[model samples]
Target chain A: MRIAVVGAGPAGVYSAQELVDAGLSVDVFDKVPAPYGLVRYGVAPDHPKTKRIALALGRTLGNPAVRFFGNVAYGLDLDLRDLLACYHAVVFAVGADDDRLLDVAGEHLWGVGSAAQLVSWYNAHPHADDSFAHTVLAAREVAVVGAGNVALDVARMLVGGPHRLAASDVPERVLDLLARSRVTDVRVIARRGPAQAKFTVPELTELGKLDDVDVVVDPADLAGADDEADSRRARANVELLRGWAERPTGRAARRVHLSFRLRPVAVVGETAVAGLRLDRLGVPSTVPAQAVVRAIGYRGAPLPGVPFDEETGTVRNLGGRVVDATGTVLPRLYVAGWIKRGPSGVIGTNKADAAETVRALLADADGFPAPLKVGPATVPALLRGRGVRFVTWPGWLRLDAYEVALGRSGGRPRVSVDDLATMLAVTRAGDL
Target chain B: MTFVVTSRCVGTKETSCMSVCPVDCIHDIGEQVVIDPVECVDCGACVDVCPVDAIVHEGEADDPSVVADAYRRFGLEAP
Candidate 1:
């Protein structure tokens, strides 16, 4: 069977690998120029080991039965109907792309940004610009709202020195800016108590290992959280946090202040973010912060012709079968990853998610339409005729070589191409 | 015009009587903001943000006993 997997993240990549292993022809497409969507651009550049997954994904794409088509967006270049007509089956694994916002006053003001935007900017996502980091680096104090692993990742990135960040694949421009950063105080504030924080134990432990960064937690913030599981985990994390808080402050470094039971009411200041007005629990007290970044969560976008739940921010699916607006199952269409389930769970979680969807596809394989054979060259020309900028396998290889060359100059494994034009130009040159 | 908050809603706290109010009479107590069921506009913003997911909207005769009990805890009179 000829299968089309939309998205080149872990979910899409793994699904394609599985299909190819089962002796099926697979074509994978992604909106980004590079594959490994979140791994390449959302994960902190310092976590080089975690990035090994991308290399594994690269190997999968190398399989003869598998083809990589980068810079292709559904609903734009190729709509759902067209995909359904071309391939025997279509699997959508497009992950959530937008960050959840706090519907409060002054949230859209200058200097206040989302954690995803900041992460994208540093990781060099094509859409991200230097404006976010420039605004954040200029501030002395910053507040990161949320208590999840991503929140901790953001907090650590802000306080981590350039030396620790040097060995990783952080973009050269971002590293230069961070090396000169004046940011000193980074407060990770959560509306819930410490025991209810969403950070895993290992992530919390990693924060304690930062030499230059101090972890601060108010004793009272742990109150009223005795019974909840999240609270219990938070208490354990706080024990480690307390140990780090007691350590002597290192010279010329930033500090991470873990604040709990604080709900941000408004972003303060006239022109830029001066401070955040927050409401503290169990007391009529409020704390002020200089910069604020909301990291509540991520939300999925609505793919044209797919049923989406606006409230939950997920594509509506029933048992891995893509559902229509009327809640009817659409044959030969499936979904996996964050789009299938709402934006939650870790990277490895997508493995199980993809496996389940693959099972459903195999069970219903006979019902799918027969695959249409269009010559490889004809496919690209057809897409081009539709005004689609489809990056061929050769183009991706060129971009890969360019990133590796760029990384060598910076003493890293790979440097990210942060714009579509640069990626297209390098690919067209056939420099790979 | 009572508004009930269920567990499925994200970020809800357990304080229920804060906004059953019809006349905008609820007052803030620390982080657990309470509503005055008497002057309430019957809007459910308070029930929505509750982290514990404990707000239940009820009609006038659904259960006055439970409503009265909640009102007493918040130091408010039931309508």
Candidate 2:
């Protein structure tokens, strides 16, 4: 059987791996010129360990039975009806691409940004805006409003010194901009206490590793982490928070305050973020800052022909099977990753999620009809007939090699090409 | 019930389990992470975090070949 997997992220690759292992032909599509969705784009540049998963994912895409079609977007390039004709099944593994808004008053201000935009900027994602660098460098103090790993990630990047990100994969220009940043203080504000924080213990404690940065934690906030600690990670986080709280301050030039039980009421500025107003359990206060990064969470947007849940920000599904609002299963359609469930879980979680979706698809395949238009030439011919500049697997390889060669001149791992024109030019030059 | 890193971890050497290992028994030699059975406290932390379900108890390994290959990759003699 032939299958089409949309979005070449962890979920799509993991699902493709399972299908190929089952001796089925799989074709993967992604909107970006390259693969490994968030790993290459959303993950922090200093996080080399987490980004290493790309090695395995790349291997899966390179398999004999699997083909990768990059630079092709769903809904725009091809709708659900188009894919359903050529393949036995289709799996949508598109990740959450949009940021969840805080809905505060001054969120429209010049300096008020989302962690998604900041991440895109540092990682050199094609969607990154040049103006984000200016905002970051211009701020003397930044408030990252959230408690999860994304929140800590922005906090770490903001307070990092000149030489802190030298060895990372961040573009030289972005690194230079960060080196000149005026941000000296970053406050990670959370509505709930530490025990209820979405942050994993390791990520939470990793903030302490920054060079000469004061890891500030309120002694009072440590109580919730200690008193109501429900899990092993919670307990461990409480221990680490207590250590930071007790440590002597004023030894460092930069400070990262881990403040709990604080809710953002407004961004508080006319044209730009001047400060963040907070409500501390009905007590009113404001933390003065030039920039605000809303890192509360990510929300999934509706795909071209997929049934989406507006409330939950997910593809409406019952264990990976796409269902309508009234709970009617749509045949031959599936979803995985952040799109399948809500935006949560680590990278490994996608494996189990994809497995269930694939299992259901396989079971349902027992009573399948014969495919009408299925072959290697079918989809390519269809896309070619329409004027889509779809990138082949070999094309992506050429681009990857060019990126690596560019980075090789410097000592860094790889310098990502953030624009589509350059990427297409590089790949086309190789005649792939 | 010491957790053994298996063949499922070969390609994806996610550091999720390694960073949380209390005894620091998990080591990324080259291809995959290996648990040092000698130092492992068998706390089951690695198993819970492993994304691919590659970790298993010593007695739960049904495929001896898979277990042996994982051990050999880590330069350990399979029991």
Candidate 3:
């Protein structure tokens, strides 16, 4: 059976991997000339280890049973109708790349942006824009609003310094920013107490371990907030946090304050962020800051011609089967990953997630109506007719090797061809 | 004996290995606080987080040094 997986991120690639292992012919499509969507873009550059997921995802796309159509966007170059006509079934694994807004006052101010944008910029994502600089580097202090590992990552990136970041696959320009940064204080603000934080303890511990950076926790904030160390993780987080609070203050250059029980009410600046207005229980207070990062959460955008839940930012699905607004299952359409569920869980979470959807899909495939279009040649013909310059699996490999060659290996991440043109040119050059 | 930190656990030792396993002391995944909330048949935590799901990608559980290094990443004594 032929299957089409839209998107080549962790979700899409994992879905495709499942299909290929089942001895099925699959085609993976992506907007960029390269694949491994967020693994290459969203992951923090300092954590070069996480980016290793790209190597495995890349191997799956190279599988003979799978075909990659890079630079071919789903909504634009091809739609649901086009996919269903060519393949028996389609799986949409598009991850939520859109940033969720803080929805507070003064968010329109110059010094506010999301952690996702900052991450994408440093990772050299093709779509990363310049606003990241204006928002993140606007002042000497950064107020990161959220309680997840992403908040920790942002805290690390902001003041972790160039010497620490240089070892990873970080882009040179981002490394330069860290080196020249005047930012000294990074406050990780959590609306609730530490009990509700989403960061895993070990990752939190890693943030604490950064050289020359002191992770300070206020004992008063812990007592002031309504905190109940209900779960082991929460207890562990609190214990670790208390340890930081009890420790003698260090003579570190930068400090990461794990502040809790404070909810951001406003960005608090006329045209740019100078302070963050916060509410502590009932008390109103403003904390000095230059820029603010909204690391609250992520939401999936509705793909064209697909059923999406606007509220949850997820594709409406039951056990991975696409269900409509009326709760009717849409046949031959399946979903996995963040779109399948809300943006939760880590990279491994998607594996089991994709497996469930694939199980349902395999069961339903026997009854699926065969595609009206025949042969592997149909997709290339259709795309070519639309003037879409797509990159094949081999083409992607050449680009991959090209990038690796351009990298300093142990130092800077491969000089990312942050523009689609360079990626397309690199892939096309290997075509001949 | 519970699972040993193998060479395969190199990169994501914290994110996947420690988090998923219930028995291991270095469970970073305790955001669920202890172990994976989702039930897995023979989940790696069974043997102290094995090469399954995210970590088992290339299945290179062959290197002794790499295994020790992965264990060292979390300050856990390698089996």
lDDT string for model 2 (A141-213, tens) is 8899998999998888888774777667777888788878788999999998888887776577679989979
**lDDT digits (tens) for residues B45-67 of candidate 1:** 34433456455565623556766
- lDDT score of residue A59 within candidate 2: 88
All candidates' TM-scores? 0.79, 0.86, 0.84
Docking quality of model 1: it rates as incorrect
Winning candidate number (TM-score): 2
Most accurate candidate by lDDT: 2
lDDT of each: 0.74, 0.83, 0.77
Please, what are the lDDT tens digits per residue for candidate 2 over residues B22-77? 34568887888888765665445576577887888776787777667655655777
By descending lDDT, how would the candidates be arranged? Answer: 2, 3, 1
> By DockQ thresholds, what CAPRI class is model 3?
incorrect
Error of 3 at A76 (Å): 1.0
- The reply for model 3, stretches above 4 Å from the true place, is A224-227, A409-413, A429-432, B1-79
On DockQ, the stronger of 1 and 2 is 2
Q: Which stretch of 10 consecutive residues in model 3 chain B shows the poorest summed lDDT?
A: B33-42
